[model samples]
Target: MTQEAHVTQGPLTTEAGAPVADNQNSETAGVGGPVLVQDQLLLEKLAHFNRERIPERVVHARGAGAYGTFTVTADVTPYTRAAFLSEAGKQTEVFLRFSTVAGNLGAADAVRDPRGFALKFYTEEGNYDLVGNNTPVFFIRDAIKFPDFIHTQKRDPYTGSTEPDNVWDFWSLSPESTHQVTWLFGDRGIPASYRHMDGFGSHTYQWNNAAGEVFWVKYHFKTDQGIKNLTAEEADVLAGQDPDSHQRDLREAIERGEFPSWTVGVQIMPAADAAAYRFNPFDLTKVWPHADYPVIEIGKLELNRNPRNIFAEVEQSIFSPAHFVPGIGPSPDKMLQGRLFAYGDAHRYRVGINADHLPVNRPHATEARTNSRDGFLYDGRHGGAKNYEPNSFGGPQQTGRPLWQPVDGLTGGTGNHPTPLHAEDNDFVQAGNLYRLMTEAEKERLIANLAGAISQVSRADIADRAIGNFANADADFGKRLEAAVRELRG
Candidate 1:
């Protein structure tokens, strides 16, 4: 059916399909004598209005999404056996969501925060989700500290507002946060719009080919619109003038046939090289330098269509890193490991257990066949199929082959253990390198940004500790930050 047929132009009817004679006036007893309880329509309207909203996501509550196509432009058969990327020119339907990390649903888009770049691929094999962020590195390497890090970013319990003291204290204590903190304070922190920034699958992932050869890979989506960013003053003005600037820009551009696109690429590392790499390749707080493994262009991702219903199509949609195809699998990255369980569990709580049955979340090219039966909002898609395996009724059975190859070594007994340290694993080196690579004006802006927040911290010692981390990264960075903060506080 065409889009126009979906529009209802007939006489109004109740949800139960009963024709309603009068919708404007409720059926009252003797003309508004206490608004009679017999009016089912009035009651229905009131109840639905009360329950219109579902629970907002704990993080990334402010977001926008678009429907798109990912056309493979290169042959990667030597690296992966994923059916979606099996041949050049293959196209897959995709939905991409852009979000702010710390904002609520009503928050403004032109803020200085890391944007979430979560992509869902509706492929022949199954749904593949790449849950990433705009920046390649994160605040911390381990998932154990995730709650604490977010707590620092969120409103303080006592004050009920985000406190600079809380944010700085956490970063000061966790030296590993230096790299991401630097990135956060830089020019790109406030992206000009969703279409102008780059996105990265920050964590390492495992990719195995048909020959069972394993490789580690990272994904990058370089915007075709070119990089653009807003300074602090520009962002403040835009935020106040029009809070929905980013969303409006994206929607109107698509409406005008100016679809945004990104060049898709991946940096693939041989599985053996990961063992003896300079730093732990799986560290979420670090990046594998392009010199070690250059990104190879593989595809083009174009967002040509806007969501018809923001609430149904975008809000109800879900993405999980654990939703992998045959060739792709999770790495040993601690942050990625925790997310494998957390993302799916969050959807079950926030969106309901049958969330997968929603049109926006369902697989496109293949029917989802599972013995798992009913839950909230279950559509009865299986239609009385056997609910369990090993039945005479011929229920769906699992494939004998596993999705990816198993790890070779299994030496350690189960206990609380830290990731094994590699030769050059300390946190400061990369952050320091980033600082030195900045142009003089860029460095000035970064220092000013850091100082602006650090100076707001009440405790002098906390401010000192925070600046000390930068000092550890580079003596000049620390000195300049200290001088800037001192001037600001004075």
Candidate 2:
């Protein structure tokens, strides 16, 4: 058979390139009879459809993403030698995903939960992923408690609904969650939109200059739209009306040319200052007050383009804390260290082994060659190079860049210790400070919100314990929450 006779320029085809005939109808014994077994297209379509969906993320599953550009407005080369931040006014391609942390795939976007602010930067060195949340601090500092913390936020096994009792029980027992719980019950719990929320690389990271000088750093992506949030009433109403309020708001705003933006800033603390800091700098549950380490303006990030395909680009898109370029590295932050493994593992399980080879996740600004080859859906095109290194055949080799300096000493035996190294690292101080900073109206709202949730707990002991946590935050705070709960119950 000649090539021209067997192949046609255009037509719907099967996997083998055989033209699909009669796609509208299946091959049948007769018009009114049973279908024939020869209907390969029907079987193929059914099989593909059955396996269309992969597992949704265990957390931050409901999300919206957009393509954007990050333009460096200030020179940060003195602090970090990352090629993307090497020069002022340099623009890097970026993709940003905004999400609700505790929500299911079908959950309302306006729920009162921490929002995720993840970014993937396509730079010359490779792709750098900043997987962070909108809040400056998290509920738990250590990664070991992550699964337990998340379980509290999820549905009750018996009821299949989120239980306030479970949530309160966990937070009350885990005093380290006090700071973040305070933030959650505050007015800002429900952000007005993804555009108005500020993002933070909550964990401390390591940044080194071209001279091998290392500095501890944290990122703050302050929303240019300003911090706007929905009140409890507003969020509740929006949740009932439009489950996808946030997703729709972002997509429509970008389409209308009102692109949202953020001012990128970094709080750079000298490596030597970390040990002497008032609080543990690497603690995910705490934040560095602006009075101490002020944020330095570094860049502006603007989301100008909506994704063309939500599933292929946004749903399948992956981000990880381990994806670092030269000059930028991880710190001893416990949560971050665990994420360095967890995020990549989740991506492999949910998006396939070669998830990075996908168009949305692939490195665009530089060539990505790796010894990693041949997995499920291995779509990368690695030109005939040997998959293994140390070969006479010329292939891509390791970089000549200087390796990161290792830690000078190690202390403490490996077992789950309830307390951290810092003697003054009690969880209540910061949470109390936060409460004292709030205005009367904000405090009233916080009390009301906290009471409303705690009031629903069927367990009186759990509710009382939660009230104690509030009291520990502030005598006034605890009294108000206790009063509110009593009044509501009565």
Clashing pairs in 2: none
Model 2 per-residue lDDT tens digits across residues 349-381: 999989999989999999788888888987658
If scored against the real structure, what TM-score would every candidate get?
0.98, 0.95
**Tens-place lDDT digits, model 1, residues 10-124:** 7787778788889998776786577889899899889999988999988898999999999999999999999999999999999999999998899999999999999999999
What stretches of model 2 exceed 4 Å from their correct place? 1-10, 400-403, 417-419
Flag regions of model 1 displaced more than 4 Å. Answer: 1-7
Best by lDDT: 1
